[model samples]
Target: MIVKKRRRPLPLTVLSTTFVLLWVLMAAFPFIWTVWGSFKVEQDFFSRDSWWFAIEGPRTIAQTGSAFTGDGYYGAWVLRDFFSSVVNTIIVTVSVVVISLTFGTLGGYALARSGYRYTFWLLMLALVFRAMPHITLVSGYLLPFFEMNIWGHLPTAIIVLVAINQPFTLWMLHSFFLSIPKDLDESAMVDGCSRFQAFRMVVIPVMWPGVITTGLFSFLLAYNDFAVTAMLLSQPNQTMVPKIASFLGTIQQEGNVMFAVAAVVSATAPLFVLVMFFQRQIVSGLTAGAVKG
Candidate 1:
């Protein structure tokens, strides 16, 4: 006798869509609020004493028609200081990404190819380094460098920023290197490649996606950081995140147009462009490393 097969149920497409929508909303909420606040006058920002959202609050700007205004962004972009901050942020971010990725890739490769005994010691060292709070390192070097007349400056700040970003990059790239099969290294060596040459020629290309991913993360950390920058670089010519934060403290905070606009414009494009540039590589590298097949 032939038996009839039961049909499987449809996938939870609607539930999946709802979950995605919720996640997107949560992520986009702060950005939306910032964008909206950027358009409105300072009065609208401070006048609303309540935490809850409302369609309209007080008409602080005295605009006749819409609550949306370009005054804040306009103020931020019209100053030379704002542009200087942007330049500083770019410099720090580039330095951190380049240095971190270079050292991280080397350290990672070494850790990945070393024997289990070597790996344990290296892993312990990494853990110790990573576990040491940035505050500890910052404080340890703060006074010594300050006495040298360079700590409270841009050069020193960039150095500290790169140092703080290195440990995370080292760990991330190490994992990426470990994910690759040993056969690739063996095959490259059989083809007359030295160990370092094999790493440079073979592993580097395969690990490019991981490098880009980690670089983006490092760049973001360097670009958005305010604490180390504020502590290490106090000069007006130094960096932007601290500049923006400093501007927030001044009495005429409303007039700091360049600060507001620069904040909005800074991370918007580079992040989007980076993702787009490595979109395909990111997907392939992620899956290729994670899956056995």
Candidate 2:
């Protein structure tokens, strides 16, 4: 085979590449700075004297005999009981995602497949509910929860998160189901599978990308929620977001800001990992779901 010299890249391509690189740097700079500062003493990181203190970490070296230290992580994770918050966050978010997905899948599939006029109205109702301010809903729930003495618990937060997230899941999954041909469900039934079996065995497999996409959104809703979690859960039951806020509340205390910074990095890392891992599925699901009206 004869080899030919490659053509020169277009100027537009070069300009676009430069813009993208600059955008990435700008987006990443805060997290990068925070991560670097998380290891240094508060004074060094938040130096009024010079920005160079953050880079050199003179105080960090003097205090810990090293340029870097894990003191903030240790303090947050151990002394501040941030690990408990992590556990609570896991419990709340996992429960929210699971419950939301379970109901969302079943309900979404039903709504998508139904021929009845009520389905449209039901979705509209759900949209209305979703559109309402979350705080108002939480306020309404407070009276019931307080009466039932179920306030300030992990399950309370989980319940509210699920309620808040369910409408979104239903809408998204319903769109996904609509994008899929109805023939798949019918074909599975024709193959001697019951409707439920068709859904569980065949339809769900094909819908896996959408499910993952919806589940991740539900996970993030619960994971990043502050207003609901803070109001519903007590101090001991608090999750990472509220816990981090509580750390900031103690900003008057020495080194507490670092604790908050460490907690932020800890909480945010999982979301970055999740998005990176499921980015392809998210894009594919969105594209597929877009095929429908």
Candidate 3:
């Protein structure tokens, strides 16, 4: 059967569509402009005379003998060694996600299945920690890190990021675990499986979506994190965000902020691809968490 909906008033429909289109253009214009400008020299992209210089690119043509140039990408990737920061980011984010999920899954499952009064208090404590500013938490670690001589390293950044992100993971996975019924675990246990075995075999497979969701969020936390990474890691060990930031500061002095622009575009591209690849899993995971069986 076909379903029909009431039509909106002409003025309201036009207004809504116009608003949406305007919002999309507003959101996309900066990135579209950045992508176009990344190929141009500073003078053309940041044209003082007319914006048409960006389109015509006379300077770019004069310098590179063509309208566009790969100088910025070459400068950042090859000359500046941006690939090291990319490697560091991958290591930190992957470590954070794996460690967070290892603990979060077990802790969340136990908390969700427990019948103790302390569970509520424990969750509230985690929530309070999660609600606190990340800088404050990072500040607390600085003194000890400096004393231990483990400050300014990739592992330190990963450890701090996990500490900051763990509470949120526990909370989210705890809710996801709650949405799962006890019968699955109980049935598995009755079939001669132990609790850990049931969790590994029966419960976890059904909770896979939730795990992916939590892991993705954990990945994003460590991936985009600036405070912990910047403050803890040394100059040689910076991640993508801080490295891009360093480009903004240093490239400005070199009179070619396009390096920073190029780096920004490079860093953002992977995140776009990652989200698209996980889109279905993310939606399903969110839906599973929201609805109870």
Winning model by lDDT: 2
What is the TM-score of each predicted model, taking all chains together? 0.76, 0.91, 0.93
Compare candidates 2 and 3 on TM-score and give the better one: 3
Task: Give the alpha carbon lDDT tens digit for every residue of 9-96 in model 1.
Answer: 4577677778999999999787666655555555555445653322353453365366665555555645435677778787777887
Clash count, candidate 1 = 4
Q: List the residue pairs that clash in candidate 2.
A: none
- Which ten contiguous residues of candidate 3 have the minimum total lDDT? 284-293
Global Cα RMSD, each model:
5.2, 3.2, 2.2
Instruction: Please report how far candidate 3 places residue 63 from its true position, in Å.
Output: 1.1
Which candidate tops TM-score?
3
Off by over 4 Å in 1: 1-24, 48-68, 251-293
Residue pairs whose backbone atoms clash in candidate 3? none
Ranking by TM-score: 3, 2, 1
Local accuracy by lDDT, each model:
0.70, 0.89, 0.87
